[model samples]
Every structure is written in structure tokens, then in C-alpha cells.
Target: MNKLPPDPAPATRLDRSQRSGPTIRDVARAAGVSIGTVSKALNNAGTLKQETRERVAEAARALGFRPNDLAQALHRGQSFTVGLISNDSFGRFTMPILEGLESVLHDERIAVFMCNATDDPEREREHLEQLMGKRVDGLVFTARRADRRPSVGVNLGDLPTVFVFSQSDDPRSFCLLPDDEGGAYLGARHLVATGGRRIAHVTGPERFEAVRLRRDGYRRALAEAGLDWRDDFFLPGEWSEQWGRQAVDILFSSTAAAPDSILAGNDQIARGILDALRDRGLNVPGQVGVVGFDNWGVMVEAARPRLTSIDMNLSTLGQEAGRRILRMIGGEHFSGVERLPCTLMVRESCGAQAKTLFQEARST
Candidate 1:
């Protein structure tokens, strides 16, 4: 009945703190402009005057307004996204390669969506299709096996795709690979210079393109030295420590000449070789010299005898892959197969001549 004394004139007051977060509308209001004007100014549309753009930007900064990437991408008809495919396992080798790729891709304001294929053809195909469905602007592949075919569940028509640390003969695909031949040549030459002979090799699958290149490098070095590459000196095996360790046993048990030098497929394999050498009471670089690939820091640093190894520079491979894919997206013509240079890090295992070879390689 009292009517609350006419509602006390409705308490004529505005709640400045009522809004949750800053919005474009709030920015427009603060800048004393219309919503369309604010949008045009923020987007740097030429239709807006410079003074209006400045005022709108100032208002946005004051209100802490930010543009949404997804919305902006939608408006621009671009996803600003890249899809990365790799092996299924979290192998130590792939991490550095991924980091390198990520660093370069992030600089270009591109988002990367990655998946592991687990070396399964079907799973890889499925993930590829999903990424394509999401409209990624580009695609990257890091396969466990060097020989891998690419796919996107579609023709991939004009989509940009690149492979890193792997290879594909598909004429349509771009591949960035380490100079395996060059790296192997450097390692073998280092061993030969360090007064190491009776050189032998413990290697991964020869079917892989990179592996074959490395083998060719080994042969080339031997040929350059006017030495015969004996089939017995080349050991085909898995890229594992067990293979290296067992190789030592095989070499020691047989009357066959023990290699004064050995080239391993990777750091892990090198570690195996070292373990077997130590077990047999042999000193690295003294009784036997060893060289490996994939200059893995953890093993090389903690190596008891300090293993000498060639670095494929997987990170550089990744960065180049990213750059090439970007260029491809920009409609630039590129070599379908790009080879990245690698380096050798000399240490106690293969003896100290590695530094000299590295220097000479750089000069050449």
C-alpha cells in the first residue's frame, strides 16, 4: 500500500563495475565512436581516418581489448593452422626436430596441430584426413621410416605439404632431409685421418633413403682412399644398442679382423658399442675408435669415453622444412627434395681430428 515512497526516485545511478570483461562495444563507447567505426579503426581499414584509428586503438588498450584469433581467421578465410604428423612413439631423437620446427612455425603466427602415426598406415591416413577437414593451411610429416607416402584423405590438390628428416618419392610432395652422405663422409674421413683403419659399420635398415646415402658416403670415403669396401665390414642390423653390443661380440669371437674403427647408425648404437668395448676391457679411441650420428647431447656428454659423432642437425632440418612450407604456401617454386647440411662433433671416441674436418668442411 505504501508503494515504497514512490521508489525513492528510482535511485538515479549507473553501475560502472557491472560489466564483466571489456568488449568492442565498451571500447567504442569509451572512444566516443560507433561500433562500425571502432571495428574499421582496429582492423586498419583504409576507410577510417588515421586520427580515428589512433583513438580507437587507445580506447582498446585502455579497455584491454584483444582480437580473437579464431574469429579473425574465419573472417580472413584462413585457418592459420598447420598439421604435423610424426611417428607414434616419443623417441628421444624426434624431440629436437619437433622443437626446431615449432620455433620457426610459431614465428609465422601459425598454429600447429600434431599427431603421431605410430608407423601405422591406416592411422596416419585417418589423422591426415582429420587435419585436412580442419582446414589447416599447411602440413608437415616426420616419419619413422624414411620411405613414407603422404596423404590427406583427398587429392591434396594445392595444399602445402613438407617432410622433414624423412623422404618420399611422391613427385607432389616436398621433402627436407639431412645430408646423410655428407655427414657420413665427414665421420669416415675423420676416422681415417685419426689413423684409424680396418673401419667397419654398424647400421640401421639399408632400405631407408637416408641410411642408403650414409652407406654410399662410407663407400665413397673408402674409394677416395683407394681402399676396398669389403662386404664383411658392413654390418646390417637394427638401430639399437643391442646391435652395437652384439657386433662387438661377433667381431671379437671370430678370427675376422677386429676393426680399429667403427661407424654406428646413431648415438644409441654408439652407446651400445661403447658398453661392449668397456665390457671387453678395451679403451675407446685407444684400442678402437667409434663414430655415430645424431649428435645426441645426453649420451655424448655423459659418455664415459666421450663418443665422437656426426650431428645431422635435426633442428635445422625442421626449421628449413617450416620455411620451405611457408614459401610453398606463398606460391613460390621450390625443389621437391631439399638437403640440409650436417656437421661432425669430434670427441675422445673417434679422437680429436674431428675439429679439423669440421673446419675444412665449413671452408669448402
Candidate 2:
């Protein structure tokens, strides 16, 4: 009789032949509320009494109900996803822009899909089509350099698109670019402030728009400082370390007075100049102050004296683009190219006095 202990009641079981587990209906039934109420409670939508929301939430937990994302998206009429297309296969510039976009998008609970076209029109077309097929809510286009590029040839009808670090030929498109002219002006002014009167600008080919804009900015700063402008002071060549070294050699060989300060086009060129200066037993900052563009951390930090350079504020550019795209997606209109400002990163290469000034200004 003790062993018998009464026959145990049969356990309740779900029908295995049908869909398994609890649905929204199950949660509603358990909570003694309507299905719509359960949905609003679970999604934190609509106005509901606290008691009812708590009851529905508890019931959902007890029944283990999970809402289907696709179904929810269909109900809301928005996928909450975006696509990022870039021709920068190496990801040097693209990564930072993506980071900035993600940082802003994360708070909004949006998702991003990324594709690299590798500077190939065919690949770009394929990726664009794939993204369109997936029904991305919006698109962001970017490139390795901040330049004007031809269209990607995708018919983006009514899709909210923003271009970053590049420009589209379309006049009505929203494009965000760094202010290269402002950045160059900052670098040149810093050198002049530190008592560098005879300044030289060694930069990449003149064919690049960035080079031309930066050179213009450099001249503007020198003119503002009342320094004499010399045509021989500007050296345009390839954007490489070898070019930097050769430019230095050529400058010294010429009868023109040796430049007191050298403004390099990019960090690579700056590094090369630093090396050449060291080999010639010239003291950086003391003998010849140096500044560079791009403020690329890898080359700047690795230089003997950390290189002072101009930062394009690419992350901020991406953030601005993100905000603009979000507004456009929300039916707000925006057009024309927006130019973001740049800042000079003062380091040892610019001389101690300049670094001190930069630090003081930053602190204030």
C-alpha cells in the first residue's frame, strides 16, 4: 500500500503534430488579455496600465513567447536595416567611417550590412543588386580617398542614400566631406606661429583635388601671415616616402634658402622626411620643424619625434552622415555637400612651444 502511493496523474502534453511551443495567443490566454494587448505589452508600444503590462510580461515569460522579427517588421513597415557600400577594399578609411556609423546606429537599434566593391564596377553592381534584393532601408557610400567619384550605376529609387568621404555627380545628393583646405591652413599656421618663416609644402600630384585644395589653404595661411609667396616653395610629385626624400634632397641642392619648416602631404611622406633629416644630422624641431597631413596614427606615432599633423575628423564625418541619412529616412529633405572641419594634432615634431600652445588650448 505504501509503495502504491496512489497512481500519479497523467502529465499534460502538447500535440507534437502541430506547431510547437507557445504563441502570442497562448500568452494572451494565460494573461487573460487580448492578443493585441499582449503584443503592445511585449513591444513596449501603446498606452497600457502598469498592472496589465506586468501581467502580460509575466505571462510571456512563463509561456516563453518570443516575437518574430520578420512579422514585426512587416507590421511596422520598416526593416530597420541599412547597407554600407565602399570601394575601399583595404578598409583603411572605410573601417573608421563604419565604426562611426555603427556607434550612432546602435542606440537606434538599427542593423547594418556591409559590402566591398574593391573598386570594381561589376562587383559594385552585384553587391548593390544583392542589397536591394534584401530590401535594406537605406544606403551609405564611401571610398578610400575623399574625392569625387563616378556613379555606382545603381538605380536607387526613393532610397535614402548618403555619401561620405566622396561625392556623387548628382547635384541633389547628400555628400559629406572633410575640409581639406581648413586642415592645411591649420598646419601651415601652426608652423608659422612657431617662427618658421621659410616654409615649404611637399605634396602629392596636383591632379588630386585634395592636393590642390590643401595647397590653396597653405598659400592662404602664408599670405595671412604676411610671408612672401614663392612658386618654387610648392613641390608636387607622387605621394610616397621616396618622393619625400627626393624632395628634401632637391630643396637642399637648389640655391633657394633651405626651408625652416616642411609641411608633408601625408604621414608616409612625413616619415620619409624625418628619416632623411635624421640621416643628414639635422635636429627636428630645432633645425627644421615638420608637420604632416592625414594624422595617421601608425606613421605619426612611429616617427622619431611623434609627427604633428592634421586630422580629417573622419569619425565625425561619418556621424554627421549617419544623422543626415536618418533624417532623410524619416522623410526630411537634405541636399548639397556638407564640409566638416579638421583639427591639428600637435606633437613633438611641431616643436615644444607649439605643443604647449595646443595643450593649453585643448585644456581650455
lDDT of 2 at 92: 74
Clashing pairs in 2: none
* Cand. 2 TM to true fold: 0.83
The numbered model that scores best in TM-score is 1
Superposition error at 79 for model 1 (Å): 4.6
- Total backbone clashes of model 2? 0
Candidate 1 structure quality by residue, lDDT tens digits, 323-344: 8878878887564776777788
Q: CA lDDT of 295 in candidate 2?
A: 77
Superposed model 1: Cα runs more than 4 Å off: 1-22, 77-80, 120-135, 353-364
Q: Model 1 Cα displacement at 184 (Å)?
A: 1.5
Candidate 1's error at 307, in angstroms? 1.0
Structural similarity to truth (TM-score) of each candidate: 0.84, 0.83
Q: How accurate is candidate 2 locally (lDDT)?
A: 0.85
Question: What is the RMSD, in Å, between candidate 2 and the native fold over all Cα?
Answer: 8.2
Q: What lDDT score goes with residue 229 in model 2? A: 85
Candidate 2 ranges with C-alpha deviation above 4 Å: 1-68, 358-364
